[model samples]
Target: ELKVEQNPLFLSMQEGKNYTIYCNYSTTSDRLYWYRQDPGKSLESLFVLLSNGAVKQEGRLMASLDTKARLSTLHITAAVHDLSATYFCAVVDAGNMLTFGGGTRLMVKP
Candidate 1:
């Protein structure tokens, strides 16, 4: 079975602070993605980490994948109020389907 879990489902993140979100999966996966969704909005792509030690980042968000360990990470730097949103990590399975993590909602106070 393939499963993914994320920590701190509701993150009351402080502004200008750094934090890391963890994703742990049950099976070996080759592809991983990080996404962000704002209130009443569709998902926005953040990063796609494809292989072991793979890392990708844009602005305040950085994501890394460890295929051997079945893990992924999303690190945030200097969080701001606008960065408050729901974050999701998804993995592509052997059949090329996506399994999404339970979303993490981050609220950053100004």
Candidate 2:
């Protein structure tokens, strides 16, 4: 069974600060996806890492994947209050099933 864990499940930071959320999986996976969810809202796709060393960035958010280590990271640069949301990372297993990590709730204070 594949298990996913995210460090620092809750993060509170001030605006203009930078932080990184890490996702680690217990098994091998070729595909990883990062998602964001606001309060009372559905999940929104953030980044997709399809291969080892894949990296994607948009605005203040950057996501990277290291398949060999079964790890993925979501880095937030210059965090703003509007960027406050719950972030999740999901890994696709060999059977094409997605296993999601425990979400990391981020709170940005202005």
Candidate 3:
């Protein structure tokens, strides 16, 4: 069985600061995805890591995957109030089932 864990669970940061959110899984997976969600909105796909060492970035957000370590990271550069949201990382198992991390709620303070 594949299980996912996210560190911090909640993050509070000041504007212009940088931080990294981590996702660790118990099993092997080649496909990993990152998503963001606002308070009451549906999830929005942010990144897709298709292979080991895959990385994708948009705006001030960057996501990377290391399949060998069963780990993925979402790094926020120069945080801003508009970037406050909940983030999640999901892994696609051999069975093609998607398992998601617990989710990290981020609050960017001004």
Candidate 4:
């Protein structure tokens, strides 16, 4: 069975702070993805890490993949109130479906 784990399942930060969320997977996979979800809203894709060392960044968020370690990371930079949301990392399974980690809910306060 494939399992994905994420550290710090919950986070509370003040606006302008920074943090990193770690995602670890139990199996080998070259593809990883990051997503953000607002309360009562659908998830929004943030970054797609496709290969070893693959990295993608947008605004205050960045994501990276280390296939050899079967790990991925989502980095938050200078967080703002609007950045408060639930974040998730998912690894692509052999069946081409996503196996997502337990989401990390973030609360950014001003």
Residue lDDT tens for model 4, 1-110: 88999988999999999999999999988688888899899989888888898888899988888998998988899999999899999889888889999999999999
Give per-candidate clash totals: 0, 0, 0, 0
Higher-lDDT candidate among 1 and 2?
Answer: 2
Each prediction's Cα lDDT score? 0.90, 0.94, 0.94, 0.91
When 1 and 2 are scored with TM-score, the better candidate is 2
Model 1 misplaced stretches (Cα beyond 4 Å): none
- Rank the models by lDDT, top first: 3, 2, 4, 1
Could you give candidate 1's per-residue lDDT for residues 1-110 as a string of tens digits? 78999987999977999999999999988889889999999999888887799988888888888888888989999998889999999988999999999989999987
Residue 92 lDDT (model 1): 87
How well is each residue in 1-110 modelled by candidate 3, as lDDT tens digits?
Answer: 89999987999999999999999999988899999999899999999999988989999999998888999999999999999999999999998999999999999999
What's each prediction's TM-score? 0.96, 0.97, 0.97, 0.96
Q: How does candidate 2 fare on TM-score? A: 0.97
Better of 1 and 4 by TM-score: 4
Looking at candidate 4, what is the lDDT of residue 76? 91
Which tens-of-lDDT digit does each residue in 27-51 have in candidate 2? 8888899999998999999998999
The regions of model 3 sitting more than 4 angstroms off are: none
Least well predicted 10-residue stretch by lDDT in candidate 3: 27-36
Evaluated against the true structure, the overall lDDT of model 1 is: 0.90
Task: Provide the lowest-lDDT 10-residue window in model 4.
Answer: 28-37
